[model samples]
Target: MGEIYVDGARCQGHARCWALAPETFEIDEEGYGKVIPGRENSGDELNVRKAIRNCPERAILERSDDEAPAKNEEVATS
Candidate 1:
């Protein structure tokens, strides 16, 4: 599974991510993009990548299995 993170402070409420993958991304009541926890890897990887790339603010980030942090504590800390 992959992980998605959104820097809410950088979000401009453009909602492009939501438009591209509503199932994976949502706008909170405050109008910022909220990457639904645990749902990031449920959708198509290409769709997720496209949505992240289309974000005007570049607030969206994705880490795939191969790119994810190692399970070791030292690796996580680093």
Candidate 2:
């Protein structure tokens, strides 16, 4: 599986990533890109990669396989 990361500080609010992969990415009201909560890699890899590549500020990141956490793992809630 693949995991995606977003650099909020570097985001330019272009909405390109969100536009390309709405299922995997979401844009805040301010227009910054976010990897949909708990869905960093739930969508197609090609689509995610496209979002990453299309990020103008290079704020998007991705890690694959062993480097990424499993999607089914339980999340600890406070």
Candidate 3:
């Protein structure tokens, strides 16, 4: 039940997020990775967490429902 967002500035077209969570992320035509529209807040449990940790660019960010309006640092670096 966590929420994920991909930082376009940090994303260098690496599809690691997509590879780790296809159902939650997708690579755009330009090859940059993005969270699938509605799936950004999906319940991936482990895959999405892996995506966040495995992202070489550290582009993928997550915030739990309880952590609103907080910075990415507020969220644990799973």
Best by TM-score: 3
Give the per-residue lDDT digits (tens) of candidate 3, residues 1-78: 567788889999879888888988899899999888878676466888888889999998776556545555557553
16: Cα error in model 1, Å: 0.3
lDDT of each: 0.78, 0.77, 0.81
Per-residue lDDT for 1-78 in model 1, tens only?
456777777899998988988878989887899878778565357777778879999988666667665666567788
Each model's backbone clash number: 0, 0, 0
The lDDT, on a scale of 0 to 1, for candidate 3 is: 0.81
Q: How does candidate 3 fare on TM-score?
A: 0.72
- For model 2, what is the alpha-carbon lDDT of residue 21? 83
Q: What RMSD does each model have against the real structure?
A: 4.5, 4.5, 7.7
Q: How well is each residue in 1-78 modelled by candidate 2, as lDDT tens digits?
A: 456778788998998988888888888898888888878655357887787778899988766556566544535332
lDDT of 3 at 26: 92
The 10-residue segment with the lowest total lDDT in model 3 = 64-73
Which candidate number has the best lDDT?
3
Tell me the spans in candidate 1 whose CA falls farther than 4 Å from its real position. 42-44, 63-78
